[model samples]
Target chain A: MTERSGTVVGPRPPTVIVDDLHVVYRVRGAGRTKEVKGGATAALARMISPRRLAGERRVHAVKGVGFVARRGETIGLIGSNGSGKSTLLRAIAGLLPAESGAVYSDGQPALLGVNAALMNDLSGERNVVLGCLAMGLSPREVRERYDEIVEFSGINDKGDFISLPMRAYSSGMAARLRFAIASAVNHDVLMIDEALATGDRAFRKRSEARIRELRAEAGTVFLVSHSLTSIRDTCARTLWLENGELVMDGPTDEVVRAYEDSAGRRSSAP
Target chain B: MSRDVIPRHGALDPEVGAAELAARYGLGVSGARPSPVEYTRRLWGRRHFIAAFARARGDGQYSRAHLGRLWQVMTPLLNAAVYYLIFGLLIGTRDGVPDFIPFLVTGVFVFAFTQSSVLSGVRAVSGNLGLVRALHFPRAVLPVALTLAQLRQMLVSMAVLVVIVLLAGQVPTWSWLLVVPVLLAQSVFNAGLALVAARLGSAVSDLAQLLPFVLRTWMYASGVMYSIGNLTADAPLPVRVLLDLNPAAVYIDLTRFALIDSFTAAQLPPYAWGVAVAWAFVLGVGGFGYFWQAEGRYGRD
Candidate 1:
């Protein structure tokens, strides 16, 4: 596969080509489910006559966003809540279908999101083993990396938390374990959605190093984060999304500056 | 997301064919379902993961109970005891049927496999949306693992089955070994039902709520407490044949013949093995095809 072009030796080659992508979430019983609009009257209207009011509502989550991600590129996605950041990541991961366009990629993209847990009833150790195995790692490989994964997640630092079932874990600890498991191997395109925000400073530094190592191995990484400091520290490029559209795609400093300025303007206008 | 990432510019021309460009770089369309052959291969590669996951879930299933793992053997035994009270003693389902306790226990244990398989299969995909969306492994693994977990429970139940028959004064013979093949055939049937249920449940999650009642009705129709042959003796030939051929009924009847000397001594139903194996083949292969048809659609929005 790598012999396809002369750029095999070159570090940067196009790995993902997402052209004119559109994602509309067709939610059923939409009178109350995941409504972007949240208020008292909306709630009242939904509760009054759900059957008559609830229909398949199309949530235009990602609209006409196009980008090409190559090997060795770490792209940061910056958007306010409800701005389709998670939806876009999910679309790239192939968990959601494209409503209009397409996402072309060389291999499977692993999307690690806050809402995705492996198994809550299993122990943290089992999750690591299962998560690695699910990603197609051999048992020997999983065993070799088992201790490193636990130490990286740091869940067992304060106590023997690895043996405890995941249901007993705090949300932060769960997220940390998920991150550690996902980062164990180098995925062609690894997308992290708000999952990295739960770790402490030491863990954050370790994960940032892991991201850089993945990039060095010619893997593409996409990170969606509210932490501007994280974006500035880890990603060289950033995409700004607002209301399900890609408003800006450029250097991290440029896009973050533009995003902050627009937020300031919106706040000052009222 | 191809690792041989090419575009240094990272820009797509509005007019240039993006599909052609991606294909030229050996990229595949994301979210496209794999071909049937490829799907099988991928599923086969994860066989160990499937087994490990099944064992984990089976061990954890009864962790909440005070007696813990002991409940695995006790819960179904208790259910059998209750059925014996209501159906065996009160209603006298044991009439004209030899060794009523062993008979009822066998029916309960055998049908329990299919019952739990269907129940867990209904939730296999819909319940594990997090794992489904988060990982790229075959979604079929969930249902298969759930069936395996039920099979683990049934294995313990079957052990208790042998002891119960011995206590009921039914001497164990070489034919008792037939339970292994019978259980294997029933497992295939149960796995197939689970696959079918997983597909339906993934589409309409409310199927999980409706399935228990449906399974209960099926259990009654399959004659877990009474002898189908005795009850349907006076019925029409067509109805008798049809009732005897019910997959669950055939499996339970086969198990009875294997364990009880009277059942083997009595005139056995014609072609019971033929019909039982046929059900296994049809559901096992057909259910897999049906579930595989919707491979890419699971856990999607």
Candidate 2:
């Protein structure tokens, strides 16, 4: 790391630094166009008009949130539906462009989304190879770890399903396979977005243990999940977001408690 | 939980830009465009992935068909049959040209290679949004891999073409060796066109709907069914030069000269090889650079 002036010293060197990051989605054709009266003249007027037939809407998914994550740290993101948790993770993983501010990572962050695009037409065995290769693992490395990947995914526990096309597997099986392929590599930073929510309890426990091992090996893990129990079990720190704003960032128990209390109050009041 | 611990909120000093903060912490900005050289190097490192993707896609194309992989060869053969029946027998495109069957087959197969590649390239990024959004690799890989898959299909089709030519009284000659280089140059050219189409298709989806018409017009003008010489003979010198220099026409002409007994060096344009090589270089390298400029923007909404 090159030394730069005006650096803020922390308790430990930061592996990921998000500085006032904002993410906005410009959704085209989101708003309805005004109806034009039915007539040839009105149709001609509509055609010649400069106004667009459909309008655009801007979704401010994340707004000026900042944080620093150090190596060997696991951070959980807890937010209500449509609260920008997934967007923030995607921004950190370089999957989405930031509308303002920036996210800096010490190494390439691998994101394991719930819908990881392993080809359904391909067999489970083939998708594992493809997924590993897409992650930049050499063919030889994938071949060497092939058996372990299959076992970790546990897709073949029922039978010879590994040889079957991925379309045959249930969503849970596919998500587990995605998680297995993603975790096969010791990524510098791993952002998992609700991948654990699909798996059974046993698989979730295994995945949580694997995440701890990854953290021990000096990798940063960011988990976004609706399941607060999983967050409490895995992350020592948590960030609470509501309506694209960070409401709290502190010890996992405190943040989770605060989030749950607010949610309870809102639900009861309604 | 410790009550005394205070959660940091936007704690970094506001004086420093994100770049300096990243540099000081050995971090790279997310979504930053890599240097061209670095991007190319990373692409090179993923060559295995590209090959695997190509092979899988190539094989997957026919998995649902009863004939399985046999469709690879049958597609071009069926196309050649339709053209042969329509243009060869009915319309009499074979009147002046000797060995018209081989010539027609060669032109159809060659042109179809580029056409299918470019057509597939249009959907390469837009169709594979799932993969693009889920993973982080060079987005160009999708286009390149799609082209490679088409190239493989073309190779299989070429085998059937060789047999048809052999049966149609076209004997092997020293010039037949030229087919290899001709195919190589055409593949490079198609790959380049595919890259351009991928970017354009992702940006403007209307290209997909408009592409078949465009390609059909291009094919008719490329002298696929007849000699380009006949079309340009009475035109002005500038028009003649342009027709002779057309890349697709040059490629088809090269293959005809290599395969058909009637197509000779005299019928070829001046410096045909030079024109073919120049098109390949210009389009291949140029399209790659153009596509790389949009690397950070492919899967975004």
Candidate 3:
């Protein structure tokens, strides 16, 4: 992959295509069932009753959502809790199975979530190596970028905590380290799920700059964050999902304004 | 909100197959399961990750222990000691067996190697859901890496076993070199079993709870502490033949025959080397293919 330093402004080829994708989560015992009355009698009743016990609940997390993501585009996914933003991102990254329809990507998408795969029992330095290797970097490349990665994360500046177990690091510190490791490579498609929400202003600034750099390298980025300010500052395009449906996909300012307006109305009315 | 502004020229028609759609749009299907050959190639590319993970796990096995890595060699030795007291001294099961201490130690160490690999394999996928969910690599790496870790542990314990054998007054002969090939065969067999266990354990997590009881029965049947010959000497011909063909017993017997002077060729099963190689080939290749077939389903509900 060629590394482009600054923003390359031009028409870019499409890198990710999601066409009428549907993702449903089958949660066991989530569906309603007839309640039994009292202790032993209820247990006996459940045993003999013709009514089916504890049906599977299908959570339609992503329903027929479709969009095209181009190289050099940084897209923001904004939604309320349980609105399928994370599910959509996961489906795009091919981590979650699509119930129907399809997701097409130009290259393997790298997903960096708050619950990333770093071992908490291992030291930060070890985690850096493991994380890099997990991302398909060779041993030599990991050694080459070891210092640069630690410097980018800035976890060592506070002290020598890089040698300490990751369990000792604060959540912000962990998230920053995860971001640093993930952004070190030039991914074809990069998805960030609320990793930036935990970091402070300076870390957030650095992370945003890194995202821009990844975009400039012709990488498609899908960022899911609850913070609208971050979305407005980082993404030119915003997708608003509500209850697993794509409510809007447009310029950041317009979609964010409309989403906030509706949210405001709903809260005021209630 | 206008769908018209965003071009849907290459959007799926819902009628065409995914491959056709990809061909039309020149897009790669995300989450597509790779062909078997392709999957193997991908796995081969991540060989470094496998080795690194195995080394880290092997080193970290005793990180928190008071005695540290001494325990790796000590745990099996202590087990051997207790077995020697019970089965060898008090029970007098060692009457017929020559150099019973070396015999028992070899059996215990070799059997424990496969036992621990299978046990660790049971949790390989379920325990590493964090890695499986966050990263995009072949799931086979988890089980294979785990087997490698157990193999390293077994190697350390085997080094100690060599010293014990030498102390037992057994001279190193040309046949002793056969121990290398025996271990290589056992590693292949254990890796295959690990793959099978990883798949089953991931599908039904209850397998983890039930595995110990099953393995305990297996350990008893494999004759880890005693010679199966003494128990089966009076049995029917077919029963004796079946016991001889038992894969675990076959491996343990091979190692014993290689390392112990008292273990003779007549005591081993007919065509011992042939049986060992066949078991390794069947289990190693077959188990891997079976596990690979379920590659896409791992870590997903």
Candidate 4:
């Protein structure tokens, strides 16, 4: 278990405290069953195997990672593809259960991930309304904010694409609308995992401004992006995870530089 | 707020640990499942979303068809026509019931509602992994919405059914109002079955493949194509009673008793409405409880 990494102590009370959180995924298919002594013995041993799921592989996606995010702080998560960055964001957002330890937060964290479309087959207009409703907005409130969501996404500036289903929208347009729907309401803890990576530079800048504004509005925000400059610019603190373990957690510059240096060392060594 | 001003690690001021600080801030475990009452409350808050989702999914399902929404009416009508030819004309299983065509069509329409609920229910949670993983609403919403979509489809079919009954020379009367209660009871029962099916299907991936065969067998046994009395007349009392008491059969019989003059109350079992209501309540509440137990585990691969 890691100790608390922040020295930004103040009356800015804690919003999210992830205490040695562990998340394991039980994936099926393409994993060898545990080997046993002999042929008949192995066959018989499978019947008596203590494992509840036979041949199911256990992927320890997030190891014991701990940190406390206080109010109004933007935390960036940077790591390799399989290094538990997304898993950590999801765990903090309460989408995945912790195999051990826990994530304590003041309120439910709203996670914005790239792959999870609100409703791919529905029109962008319908998706905005449904998204607002799904986030617990009243029907009246949805009506009120409907135009705001559409305008903020800017999908209609080119044409009348908002009336069309999201499946017809370019991926970037979909991502922009998804971000707009999620950011419409101020969540207590907002976690973003590469959700903004698809948009154009102008849209990205507009969203970064929105994220900055949200930092003062919400309890905390956690961002995970492969764009190192995005991480460097958006987040104040950064967490570096490798092979399901947190390799570093400190100021954004220090942690990102350390992660890059390690990658450089690995590439040069071979 | 001064941006990016946080200092180095191991600087928690020594006396205060992270957990202690979180405790002071009154933070609870974020990923913990809500208690049943709380879950119900949160589900209630999502009622608007559920209804909208149900309507959108139900309507858009047939959007790609050439005939558009007409297929909603046509699919079941065509099914009714097939059953009528096979049973009413070829097999002659009418068993002296008056208005046999109406009886058979009503059975097919009502049974199809339950069949659709069970079929979609099986895939409701697992199929919507995108929505399930992306957002946090009650997982029950998917099953409930699926059943509701089926319920809406049934209502459209019901309107056509009313025209069919009128054309068959059935005079309107107070008993016709019974269709409302029958539909309410059946919808609740269907939603309940959906919930139960969603839970089982979420864990057992093979259930989706196996459910149609099971449902088809259920349709045959529920007397959808013929009168139970004629089919089970030679069987023992208990076998007949079980067949009569079957939930699917009970729903179809209630709808028949209300609509067709020949399929009157004496033809039904003792306290038929009571049996129907009981089935609805049991499955509605019990299935919801069964699904709620695994609320947090729905989207796991």
Chain A TM-scores of each predicted structure, in the order given, are 0.89, 0.87, 0.86, 0.87
In model 1, how large is the Cα lDDT of residue A190? 93
Whichever of 1 and 3 has more lDDT, that candidate is 1
Flag clash pairs in model 3: none
Instruction: Report the Cα lDDT for residue B221, model 4.
Output: 94
- Descending-lDDT candidate ranking: 1, 4, 2, 3
Worst 10 residues of 3 chain B by lDDT: B1-10
**Higher-lDDT candidate among 2 and 3?**
2
lDDT tens digits by residue: candidate 3, A116-147: 75777778898888878877899999999999
Residue range A1-270, candidate 1, lDDT tens digits: 545555555545578888889987666764332324534323333454434325755567777998888878999999777677888888888888898889998799989988788888889988999899888888999999999999999999998999999999999899999999999988999999989898888889999999999999989999999999999999999989877788998889989999999999978995
Each model's lDDT? 0.86, 0.83, 0.82, 0.84
Runs off by more than 4 Å, candidate 4: A1-11, A30-55, B1-19
**Candidate 2 lDDT over residue span B1-301, tens digit each:** 1111213432555566556757766798877789889998988888999999999999888887999898998899899899989999999978888888888998999999999999999998988876887777888888899899998998888888889889988888999889899889988898899999999998887899999999999998888888778667789999888888889989999988888777899988889999999999998998889889888888776
Q: Once model 4 is optimally superposed onto the true structure by TM-score, how far is the C-alpha of residue A31 displaced, in angstroms?
A: 9.5
Model 3 C-alpha lDDT per residue in residues B1-301, reported as the tens digit of each score: 2122334333333455444534544678787778889988988888898998888787677877888889888998998998899989999889889999999999889999989999999998988887787778898898889999999999989899999999999999999889898899989989999999999999888999999999989888887778898888899999888888888898999999999988998878788899899999998998789889888788775
Candidate order by decreasing DockQ: 1, 2, 4, 3
Candidate 4 lDDT tens digits, A85-169: 8878878877778899888888788888888777777789889988888888999999999998888898998999998988999
Candidate number with the higher TM-score (2 or 3): 2
**TM-score of each predicted structure versus truth:** 0.94, 0.92, 0.90, 0.92
Return the lDDT, model 1, position A71.
Answer: 79
